[model samples]
Target: MRLSARSQRLLSLVALLLALLSALLGGWGYVNDSAAVLLAAPLPLLIVLAFVFGLSQPDADD
Candidate 1:
């Protein structure tokens, strides 16, 4: 589904927050020696990259 500009921004913000959370989780897992953090890390990094890139583009309406 296509999101409106406001929705796109909101989604991007949420993605940013999730990315931070994932990083935190990775750090915590590292201290605890959990293997799952490795898998969890890249996906959110990629997602944050995508959302930031998408948000950086000029608005179609502008």
Candidate 2:
């Protein structure tokens, strides 16, 4: 899928926020195992995958 420049920028920002949220949640979970397992477990991986996919997208001009 191709994204416009604005969309690309928006996705990048979203990816950044997701990463930060994942880290914060992971750290919080580390101090509280239950929270980590229940809340932060899949977020980091999911965010990473999203970032990868977003970056891998072919350019619209391509």
Candidate 3:
């Protein structure tokens, strides 16, 4: 299924927000000495990157 341009943009925005939240949580965890949280923080960033990469790709129909 293809998303409209607006939907893609919205999805990207949400992904970014999630990444930001994850980073903040990671920072908090770092300050608190929680290794588990720190390790998990980067996962959302990877997901955001994936979303960005996927969105940047040209549609096969193009």
Candidate 4:
């Protein structure tokens, strides 16, 4: 199912925040030797990339 424009924008914003948080967590993990955080680091980035791509696409009705 497709999201409404507002929802899409919100999702992209949230994804961006998650990506930044993940980066911060990754850095913290590296400094603290936390393996779990390291493993999770890429997930948010992947999510953010997906949302960014989604945001970049022209809307279906466009």
* Top of the candidates by TM-score: 3
lDDT scores of the candidates, listed in order: 0.62, 0.63, 0.64, 0.64
The CA lDDT at 11 in model 3 is 65
Please state the error at residue 53 of candidate 3 in Å: 11
- Report how far residue 2 has shifted in candidate 3, in Å: 1.3
Instruction: Flag the better candidate by TM-score, 1 or 2.
Output: 2
User: On a 0 to 1 TM-score scale, where does candidate 3 land against the true structure?
Assistant: 0.47
Write one digit per residue (lDDT tens) for candidate 1, span 1-62. 34567766666676666556667767776534254454445666657655676668777799
* Model 2, span 1-62: residue lDDT tens: 55566776765676567556656877866546565455545556666655676788877799
lDDT of 3 by residue, 1-62 (tens): 45567776776677667556656766666435365455456667767665776678788899
Instruction: Single out the weakest 10-residue window by summed lDDT for candidate 3.
Output: 30-39
Per-residue lDDT of model 4, residues 1-62, tens digit only: 45667876676677567556656766766445365455456666667665776768777798
For model 1, the run of ten residues with the poorest summed lDDT: 31-40
Better of 1 and 3 by TM-score: 3
Clash pairs detected, candidate 2: none
Error of 3 at 24 (Å): 1.2
